[model samples]
Target: MNTRKALYQFGYRRSPDQDRPTPAHHPVVVVGAGPVGLCTAIDLVQRGVPVILLDDADRIGEGSRGICYAKRTLEILDRLGVAQTCLSKGVTWKVGKVFQREELLYAFDLLPEDGHKMPAFINLQQYYLEHALVERAAQLPDLDIRWRNKATGLKPRNDGARLTVETPEGSYDLDADWVVAADGARSALRSMLGLSFTGEVFEDRFLIADVKMRGDFPTERWFWFDPPFHDGRSALLHKQPDDVWRIDLQLGPDADAKAEQAPERVLPRLRQMLGHDNFALEWVSVYTFQCRRLERFVHGRVVFVGDAAHQVSPFGARGANSGIQDAENLAWKLALVVNDAAPERLMETYEFERSAATDENIGHSTRSTDFIAPRSAQELRFRDAALALARHAPFAKRMVNSGRLSTPSTYETSLSTPDRDAWAGSARLGAPLPDAPMRDREGRPIWLLEALGGQETILYVSNGDPPPCSCRILTIGHDLIDENGFFEQRFDASPGSAYLVRPDQHLAARWRHPDSSMIERATRRLRGFDGGAA
Candidate 1:
């Protein structure tokens, strides 16, 4: 067996059909073995859900280039329990230098020292990320990852869904209880469902070059703004975990695909940016892309994820991270519904929450690009000036950094809701709570992230008598909570105010004392389980 086939069999374990008496179909059919597809499959298989993951590619390549693994993406991988393998070889960028003109204004402390949900950002090539995910998925006894298998006619059936699959071996008929169309922006599945991919295709083309070098570059992101190097368009310089530098050059509007991508043309751009005196070009590709997303991520039993669900400019690195988050959110909910833990309608929330997130992230990445790398000269100058001011001004810096690297855009219509007793005040409404530091019984500062334990919980900080509920109630201070209730000291919040947080680390409601039944109502609407457990 080839390295990939061997690793997959040993890792995710997708067995090839022997005699094939029209083999029985799986419960979940994931079409697209990209990062999103692979991640989703791994989650399902590990959870004991039978799944069949398919990809159009002969191998993981072309269609969706999986590059630039961010910090949030790493955290998601860590949650999968296989991040160490990737981190051991992926690039870690703790420091990044943001530039304006010729001056190096301020370096962004991208990674926080406090315990992270996962390791900081790692720069591993897409190939490696795919290999790792595929390996993990293969190890699952319930997963069947088929290579060189392209899904054709996908139609939902009465009790389940049927598909016309074309494999290198032969054509076959397959059936599944569920189908996920993660085929990407130009998803054949989405088109087959007559679902409209709504959004503007921003006319932008970028040329990406990956080169292996012997010298050492800083373990930080270097962004040059309208520098003398690559003409007017901005140049982003980053180091991959494999000691390869990924350099991007914004192609001009009139640039030709054929003429521009010639090795002669690409090597010159690299030479210009790297001082015309150094650097080597290992791999090059010219990519033309637009920002677009589907109006509805679901159409009956077939669901969409990753670029297939939505496509955004890779400015804030939110595109892939959001995709991974979608995979995680849908995986658990799908498992619950499949096992009858929750109603089938619960799966609808995936559309509600993820669609909302994709919309916001699209706007964020689009807006960041105008500043990160403007299209025109006038726009570039305006962005250059903005960065110059933000570098010196605290407020400006905070605003820019918060929007760029920071998450928590807000989830107003999520299916999961907080208990009314958990509700404290506005602090609990649609936002991530600000963190404060305090020592634990061990005398070391306690991290709120650790308190989360990767699940939904509540933190009630009240001055008056503490109310009762089930989900992780930690009453801080001497109010009615007790001496052990002093957890408020950890986040430096008010002594008597209680805040309700959700499983995804976003706040639900907050109040100083007994106020309203808003939290309880929301919780009921989400899980449908009325009582809170101790």
Candidate 2:
């Protein structure tokens, strides 16, 4: 017996492409309508690239799968025009507390700084996110979302790929210049392309239960290692919207996954942990961790994103957050490639940067899993010692990883030009630009990121003499005045200093003082017109 309600159910409609005599063609076809696919479609369409989004399911599922959206993820959502909705409807949090057997250890803040438009994190049901994305997609005329349209077969080609899509009415052939496989972990397109993930799968099992009850629990992440209720096991608590709470409990490797999810078994565990039986189970499931990813995200004209490309444990909230980042990173480059503005090799950078990010995420996730679910007695002993020391020693607290939460990945790509002079602050080469409050030319308040737009622009600190450059330039003190001094402190800006920002908001290059030739050369390299890194 489940206590869940359907949020939205979209009806399937026959696409006119199926009625055409020959195979209908599209610029880009996104093979899944999940968050990643929707994001990919939305970003591409906003960039003037028409995208057809296909999903096998016509409705958002009842399960609250991904509840935590990181600050970086929220920023990307804001760019796509849906972050405000998520913030308004979801629970916002930044602090997390870790415990050992009912003993208080320590709490940590995810975001201690201010002057940013988004919060550190937000907890909203995956269904609500999908609904918001769907609503956004509807507003864009170039984004065509096909419900109940499933991709069944694929034929790879040099110019593009051909997909055989199956619908309730019948199956039809569709050709696309490029295909994005956001179809998830069990990707049909991945199998069709003969791709396999390479990594480790932990044997330990964990149960997730979303309970509904009215309580005064503060909005924060709580992780307990070997709590009193579940002796020798771990438990996690998180507040969600609508008086719901997410609980995760480690069930060891040998526990019966099927039996653990039963209401009778789940209810008892909740009663012991909560000291009452006032909660109703909304959703329950058991899962094992698999830290894995494809060797290459790009395969000819077919690209994989989200679970189709990588998989990570949910402990760190890395799974969905990383996937959303994948969409953003790929969207801008893919649009440029589709528009013939950049070389085909530009896609290689997407493959390189995102794969590096996946490896970083996998490594962290693997370490977290090892610490959380120690396989041997020696490993468990080490974990116990670390937890004991974490109570007092700050160094030991850093060692204890309940799950290091998700953060934006800085790409050390060939596209980023090496600095000509020493630099300081968090505005390093190949990092996402830190947001700061500033005033636009009209004296209106705006964010540093909001003014960058979706193009490579030059961020120049002005001394009343701007550098001569052919690229778009946003001159500080002229276009945007940093009244709060945050932009100056965050970027270590000085008069005549300039920074090149990528379309995805990452730093591409910077210099203390640069001429027109220097700016043009770096722009060429970033555009993939030049060969080696500058």
The most accurate candidate by TM-score is 2
Report the number of clashing residue pairs per model: 29, 0
Q: What TM-score fits each model? A: 0.80, 0.99
List candidate 1 segments past 4 Å from native: 1-23, 61-64, 276-278, 372-381, 387-403, 406-409, 414-523, 528-534
Candidate 1 lDDT over residue span 396-452, tens digit each: 654343126435445565453443344332233565444434344445555454454
Native-structure RMSD, model 1: 5.5
Instruction: State the displacement of the C-alpha of residue 110, model 2, in Å, after optimal TM-score superposition.
Output: 0.9
Residues 224-323 of candidate 2: C-alpha lDDT, one tens digit per residue: 9999999999999999999999999999999898999898889999999999998789999999999999999999999999999999999999999999
lDDT of 1 at 419: 38
